[model samples]
Target: MQSLDLRRSGAGHAILVRGGRMARLVLSAALLAPLGACGIPYGTGSRVTLSEAPPSAQSTPSEGIMQALTCMRDSHTLNRIRFGIAVHSDGTGKSSYGYEGATGSFLPQGTAAIWASEAVIRAGGLSMNYYELNTERALRQFGGSSLDTALATQQQTRVPNFIISTAFTALDFIGGPSMDIRAGGIGPYYNVRGASLEVSAEMYRPGDRMTMAISSLNRQVFYRDAGIGGGRLFGKGKGELVTGTIGFTDQQRLQEATRDVIALAVADVLASMPVVPDDCRQMVENLKAAHKARVNEDRPQEKPAHGSRARRDDLPAQSPAPRIPAEQGPASGTIANPDKARRNQR
Candidate 1:
C-alpha cells in the first residue's frame, strides 16, 4: 500500500510541473500577439517595412504664402535684407519629456536654427551662410569660389538686417492636470497626461548682437505615462513572477508639433519687421486669426504685437541701409528698386 501511494504522488507532481509550463507558454503567446501586428518578431532577422507618412518635404506652414507672393511679384520684399542665424544655446540640456531607455533630449536646438535659416531661404530672401566655413575656405584655397567669398565676406562683416536666435525656455509636466487610470490587473486601461513646452526667440542686429524684437511660443505636449506602475497584480501561484505591461493610448506627435512651432516663429519674425510686405503681412494676420498665441506673444519691452505689422515708432532711429547703385545690388537676389526698399527700412 505504501509503495502504491508513493508512485501516485510522483505522478501528481509531474502533472503539476507540466501544467505550469503550459500556463507560462499561454501567457507569453497572449503578450507576443500584439507584436505580430506591430512588426517582425524578436530575433527574426527580417527587414521591417514602416508605414508611409504623409509627404511634407520639410515644408513650413508659411511655404504656400511665400510661393504665392514671390512668384507673382518682382521679388520678395525681404529678399534685399540680409538675415543671419546665430547659436546661443542655453537650454539644450534640460529635457521635459522623459522615457527610460531613451537616449537624447526630444527638443533639439540645432533643428530650430536650421529651420529658421531654411524658412528665409525658401522665401526667396537673402541668408548669411555662417556654416560650411571649411568648404568655403577650401574653395577659396583652390581659387574656385573666391569672388563669391569676397562679396559675401563684405556683407557678412557688416550688420545683418536681422539675426534670428531661439532657446527652449520651459518644459512643464502637470500632475494636477495629468490623468492616470487603471483597471483589472491584466485588463487594458486608458491614460491621459498633460505637458507644455515654451520657446522664445529674439532678433538682433548682427554686428553688435543688439536685441531688436522678442517673441515667445508655447505648445501643449501630452504623453501617456508608462509602466505596470506599482499596481496590484492578480495571479494564481503562492510564488508568482512579474514582467512588463501592455497599454492603449495615442502616441504624442512631438516631431510634427516641433515643425509647426518653427514655421510659426519664422512667420512671426517677418511680421515683426519694420517694413513687412503687404502680402506677407496679410498672411501673418490670417495666421493670428486662425491660431492665437502659437505664433508669438508681445511683451512690454518689445515692439508691436508679436505677429502684427512692426511699429515703426518702436524702431530706433538709425541711418538707412546702405544703398548700392541700382545696377549692382547685393551679390545675390538683386533688388529691382533699392531706393524704395531702403525707404521701407530694408
Candidate 2:
C-alpha cells in the first residue's frame, strides 16, 4: 500500500510539472505571435534606405566664398592671375577649445588650403596651377646637389605669378558669466559669449620675391541668449531656470567665421591683381542657381494641404501640341463641328 501511495504521489508531481510547462509554452507563443505577425525583425541586423544627405555646415562658407568671387568678378577687378597656395600655419602656436572640451590648433591646415583654392577658382580671375606646390616640395626634398643638378639639367618649371600664404595670428574667447534665478515659478536666464579670430595673409611674387599685397582681417563671432518661462496649476507650481550660450566653442561657427574672414582677405589681395575681361556673369548666375537648388533639395519637403490638388511644380512639363497636317481632313468617326451636328439632329 505504501509503495502504491508513493507511486501515485510521483505521478501527480509529474503531471503538475507537465501542466506548468505546457502553460508556459502557450504563453510564450501567445507573446511572440503578435511580434511575428507584425513582421518585426529579430537579431543584430538593421535595414537602411538610401537617401540624399543634407548639405554640411560648410555650405555657408562655400557660399560666402562664391559670393565674394562673384562680386570681385563683377567689379572687373579680378584678373586671371596664376597663383598657388602654400600650407597655412598657426602663427599663434596655441590650441583652441570648443564645446565639450574639444581642442584643436588655431588654424586648420587642410581647411585653409581648401578655402583659399576654392575662393581663387570661384572668383574667376585666377588660374590655379595645382601642381605648383607638389613640384616645389619635390624639388626641396632633393636637397642641395641633387636640386642644383636637376635645376641645371631639367627644363625649368612654370612658376606662379603669386604664392599665397596665410597665418592664424590670434584667437580669443571671452564671456561665460551667466546667471539664472527662479522665484514664484518664474525666472529668466541670459548669457553672452564672443570669440575673435585674426588672420593675416600675404601674396608674394616668386620671381621678384616681393610682397604684392598683405591683408589682416579680424572676425568676431558671438553668442547670445535670453529667455523666460513659468507654469502654475491648481494651487501647485513648479519652477525652472535655463541658460544657454551660442557661438562660443562652436566648431562649425568658428569655421564659418574663419572662412568669411579668409574670403574678405582673399578678395582684398586679389583686388590688386590685374584684371582681364572675361565673361563670367553667366557662370556666376549658374553657380547661384545650383546653390539654390541644393538648398531646396535639402529642405524637408512639405506635404500638400488636405483636399488640395498636387502642386503645378511637381507635375511633368506638358508636351507641345502635335502639328496637324493641313491636307488631312477630320477623322471618319469624329464630327468637326458639334453645333452643326446638333442642328442636323434638330
* Candidate 2 lDDT by residue in tens digits, 20-137: 9999999999999987756454545954435789877635355545665777656655554667777776776667577474557545654476677667776665655443466766
- Residue 79's C-alpha lDDT in candidate 1? 66
Please give each candidate's TM-score: 0.54, 0.50
Tens digits of lDDT, candidate 1, 18-86: 999999999999998887667654556766677889887755545544553343234456768877776
Q: What is the C-alpha lDDT of each candidate?
A: 0.61, 0.61
RMSD of candidates 1 onward, in order? 13.9, 29.2
Would you give me the overall lDDT of model 2? Answer: 0.61
Off by over 4 Å in 2: 1-41, 44-65, 74-80, 96-103, 126-155, 176-181, 228-252, 274-346
Give me the displacement of residue 116 in model 1, in angstroms: 0.5
